[model samples]
Target: MREALIVWGGWPGHEPEQCAAIVAGMLRDEGFQVHLDNSTRAFASPQLSTMSLVVPIFTMSKIEKDEVSNLSKAVREGTGLAGFHGGMGDAFRDAVEYQFMCGGQWVAHPGNIIDYRVTVTRPDDPVMQGIGDFDYHSEQYYMHVDPSNEVLATTTFSGEHAPWIKGVVMPVVWKRRHGQGRVFYSSLGHVAKEFDVPQMRTILRRGMVWAARE
Candidate 1:
């Protein structure tokens, strides 16, 4: 059976483990085998080559060296990486290797948790076929993104938070390749309510499938 190694935990504020379970169930429904872990250490039986994907729900911290190396190699060689918001981006900020594999880092989210809109940049992508530009009430993120990344959706910065941060556009959802592996990220998550939105859930569900590198 097709399988995925789901690594989650750290910072209950981001609800990484809980969210990972939600996503894992989604994959299980799709008939994929899943291995779940909520540890701050390395994978015990990690043979990156055997998994179809790696889902990290970790946030703002350091991970063991072995886990980082295995995950990096896995994605670089070809297992998919998928997660939303800070769970993946805010993780291991000091680890350049991790940041390099992640493609971007979370600098600041100026407006606080508030309402904002996301416009699809790659509307033609299968992950966004039925989903159109939509608005939601949550933390509107403002991040310094990777220019090499393929941005799929973006949000405009309004002068409400930082008048000086004007004319900046942030990618709310995107995808990029790490060697032969595919990676996907979305900045739409902050609170549990964010996951309840049909648009958010659908976007992530499709994104997971897309990131699975099938």
Candidate 2:
């Protein structure tokens, strides 16, 4: 059976523990043997490379250099990496190398907890197939994204929230590669309750599966 490791912890504001539970349930339903951990130190395990996927639900925390090194090496050698919102996008701010692997960093959420729409850019992609542009109610993330990311969904910023970026179209979901591993990230899910939204949940589920080593 494919194994997946989920390490969740950090700022409680993001509900990392709750979100991790939801994700763990999702993976179990998909036939993966899931391991749930509450500390970033889990990344330091020598067995990390044996897992098929690594889901980091950690946000705004410091990761030890050895732990980060091991985690990055495991992914580079083919373990998959996938996450959503600040869990993955806002994690380990001091580790630039980790940020480089994630492909984007959460810089701001203008007009926090507001209504917005997500537009599918690559509906034909497996990760986006059958999904349509949907209205979302949460923090609309403004990120510093890697240009190489294969953007799957996007959102347009109206001047009402942040005037300077009004006409800007920001990537809401994207997939990329870190060495031999598949990396996926979504800038949605400010809190666990947001998972009640079908579009939000579905996109995340599919993204995680897609990021798993095949």
TM-score against truth, every candidate = 0.94, 0.98
Report the CA-based lDDT of candidate 1 relative to the real structure. 0.80
What is the C-alpha lDDT profile of model 1 across 1-214, one tens digit per residue? 7788788876789887678888888889877898888775644345766787777788886776776777888788888888888888788777777778777878888778777788988889988887899988877777667788988888888878889878788888888888888888887777566788987888887887888867
In order, the Cα lDDT scores of the candidates are 0.80, 0.94
Best by TM-score: 2
**Consecutive 10-residue window with the lowest summed lDDT within model 1:** 40-49
Inter-residue clash pairs, candidate 2: none
Across 1-214, the per-residue lDDT of candidate 2 in tens digits comes to 9999999999999999899999999999999999999888899999999999999999999999999999999999999999999999999999998999999999999899899999999999988899999999999999999999999999999979789999899999999999999999999899999999988899999999999997
TM-score of 2: 0.98
Model 1 collision count: 1
Count of backbone collisions in candidate 2: 0
